[model samples]
Target chain A: MLDAVIIVLRETLEASLLVSFLFVYSNHFSVNKKWMFLALVSGIAFAVLVALQLSEISDLYDGTGQEVLFITVLLALSLLIQWINFIVIMPNYLKSNQQLLKILFSSIIVLAISLEGAEIIVFFQSSLANDNHFHANLLGSILGLGIGISAGAVSYYLLNQLANTGVIICLFLLVVVSAGMASQAVSYLMQADFIESGYPVWNTNTLIDERSVIGQLLYALIGYEATPSFTQVIVYFSYVLIPSASFIYFKIFSVRKN
Target chain B: MVLSKTGSSVKAKRLFLIHLTMLVIGIFSVDASAKRLTIEIEIKNHFFIPDKIEIPANTKIKLIVHNRDSSSEEFESYELNREKLIMGERKANIFIGPLAAGEYPFFGEFNQKTAQGWIIVK
Candidate 1:
């Protein structure tokens, strides 16, 4: 049951952080909350489908196909959001483009949160179905959900303050988080040998083990890996660079043109 | 100088693309071979027996995780990005890399503290 709490907490906190970030952003942009709520509903519905088809999905592509699908979807969504943010949102931010941006960004959040939520639900259901610790597991999960949601609320408040001071900081955080997810997606592919992963550049296990409390938080936040391969490092940096560069270019050069 | 530079750069780009394509094919062929490499791992008392495993670089290997514990366990690895929930007293078959030489870490998600191991590819 303790283990159940720990696992649920980890997955829940990740999804919660994404939700809170979206919430704050939408509030600032004056977008209707209804659209976001609808996205959440749709995402949950999709997750149910994923959970139901888990076995079939797991069996595809010599048993590595599920990871392939996950990585592809995450990478695609990250790229799509980043591309849209640069090409559409940044330039038109001061103007009232809230409606379109609201829908676009909300869908991105839905994709991330729903996939994460699906995994948690699947984990919970499996554990419940197999084990006799029904009471303990249920209690643990409730506690985990409470803690995770509170953490998200706190972070949202702090980040909202930061946004008030400077929107660029928020933008940087958003882009960095997206890049981190992309790097993680690449690591999944590497684990399955869907992509080439070179030798480890270094191991920081002694200094900061990824299994530690702080390490897990950092992993969720910034995609920190204690031992990263050369390919992962390259992917991480390129993911961070390409979108950020586009942002800077559009911010500076496009504004100049205006 | 500009013409030669552009020509060389274009050639380099094409060469890199060719290498990437070959890498993809190499991985596919490695998977298709009839020779199946199998490794057995046992989980007892929330610990992985023979925690450190080594396999040849660039080959598909099958891993059989036998969980002796009466409680459920999830074989999870951030490095390997593979997670499987094996019900207590059950077993799971996990297929891993034709990988580049590196160390990959995995743990039992239900018992992370006691159940840790590594896969070393050489």
Candidate 2:
């Protein structure tokens, strides 16, 4: 039962956190609630389709198709965040049409949710089918969902409070999250041998096992890996450092100079 | 200074994007040749049958994972970087590499305590 709870919580929290973050940010721009609703509905529907077609998807690209698709989505999301940053910085960027900007961000949020939600849905469905302890798993599932929603709410509240500090910090966090997603995609590529991973960097399994509760939370928050390969460590650090440095430079030095 | 910094960062991002795109295309093109040397493993009671599988080094091999239990399990390997969720009573296929001799450990993410296994590439 705890296993069921953990699985559902992890999956749901990942997507929910993204949703809450974006939704809270959208409030600052007065994004249309209706558009967000539509995006959420469609994202879930599309996720169902993806889950249903798992067999075919798994069979794609000689058994590495799932990783390919997953990577493509992660990269797309990363690019989308950069575009969002551009939109935010440029005045009259959407031709003074705030609605369009809102719609765009909402759609991307939907896409992120769909990808994460589909996995959770599939896991629950399969677990319910296989296990005899349905009631127990169901209870665990409910608890997981509750915890996930609470976590999202807490994040939304924190971001809302931090809005007084300006959108800079929020944007930084978003950039970090995007980088984490990209690193995860890289891991999949390395797994498929699409990318060369030279060696294991270090084993922190003794100090902090990624399977533990705190480790899982960190994984969802920032993609913590106990034992990462050489390639993964390099990519992860690059993603973290580059965007952050750029953001700080642009916000502080560039703004002051201007 | 800011403009140059942003510009340099954008260039780096673009380079990364191009590398990823090329790799994607390369994978699709090369996948055709990877459909050889099939290996089978079964899971029962959250445990992989014959948990240690030895295969020839430097060969592209197909892995067929059969999940005999009634529940689904995600076959995860940080070492191998391949993760696939195999539904109970169903079989899933995965492709693994032409590689150096090493031990690649894999386990069921859902049943990590019981479902541990390794692929020995020799």
Candidate 3:
């Protein structure tokens, strides 16, 4: 039962946190709310498709297909975040460019939800098939989902309370999330042998063992890894630095020009 | 800068295409090099058949994980930075290594207490 709770909570929290961020972005822009309908329908539908075909997927690309697909999704989300950041910073630069925003928001939701939702779909499929823990697992699943959604909701409300500042915070968060995704993508690439799995840059498992509950939560929330390779560290920092530095540089240069 | 007055869709589209090309190139390049070792680990009754396995340090390794039980389990490892879902009676391939000497722990997320194991890199 506890296993079920933890699995669902982690998966749900990961997807919902992304959704919550996009939701706030949508509110700030006054973009159409119709995207939720599209995202839900497509996300769940694709999740079911992915879950059903997962075994086949694992078999492709000399059995590195899973990592390949995972890498693509992570990188895609990161790229979309870059676009979203630009939109957030220059909302009215192109008044009629709301279409692009709509597309970005919708794509992020679909990709984020479907990737995480596939795991949940697989969990439920497995759970329903097993009679021994059906009742307990079902209860845990519900509890996990409730808590996960509630956490996302609370975060949404918190950012909303901050009003204008919330958008700024969200912009920062989106950047951080992209950095995390980049790190995760690098890990997958290393696993696939597309990139070398060099020696780890550092290890901090003693401080907060990655297997611990907090570690897992942090992993889901921020892509935390205690023993990251040198490649992963370099890529992660590049992500965090490049966008932020570019944004600040642009801001300072524009102020001077004005 | 994409939203700047001088921002052009052609450049954005080109940048997107470059990223896509690099990704596609990565996919095709998987065959450019071959791993030196392949390891098999089976999960029967929610436990890794060989709960402890060893490999040489700094060597890329391919892992074929076969699930023999009637339940699903997630193959997760913090040290190895790998995770995959293996359905009942199905198998998944997990590639790892080229690492420094040490022990890397992994577990089945669905049955953590019982489904634990380690990779000894030496």
Q: Best candidate, DockQ-wise?
A: 3
Comparing candidate 2 with candidate 3, which one achieves the higher lDDT? 3
TM-score (C-alpha) between model 2 and the true structure:
0.79
RMSD of 1: 6.3
lDDT of 1 at B95: 66
- Kindly list the per-residue Cα lDDT of model 2 for residues A103-204, writing each as its tens digit: 667777777877887777777776677566577778888899899989988988888877745366556666667767877887778655576544457867
Give residue B84's lDDT in candidate 1 (0 to 100).
Answer: 74
Summing lDDT over every window of 10 consecutive residues in candidate 2 chain B, give the lowest-scoring window: B78-87
| Best by the TM-score measure | 3
TM-score of each: 0.77, 0.79, 0.87
Relative to the real complex, the DockQ score for model 3 comes to 0.44
Off by over 4 Å in 1: A87-89, A93-99, A130-132, A254-258, B1-36, B42-60, B66-73, B78-105, B111-122
Model 2 reaches an interface RMSD of: 3.4
Residues A109-203, model 1: lDDT tens digits:
67876677767776676556545656777788888878888998898888778765434555665676777778778777765665654556887
DockQ (0 to 1) for model 2: 0.23
Angstrom error of the Cα, residue A36, model 3: value is 2.9
The better-scoring model by DockQ among 1 and 3 is 3
- Model with the higher TM-score, candidate 1 or 3: 3
Please, what are the lDDT tens digits per residue for candidate 3 over residues A127-239?
A: 77678778888999999999998988988999878888887888888887888888999988987777777777888999988879888778877778898888888888887
The order of the candidates by DockQ, greatest first, is 3, 2, 1
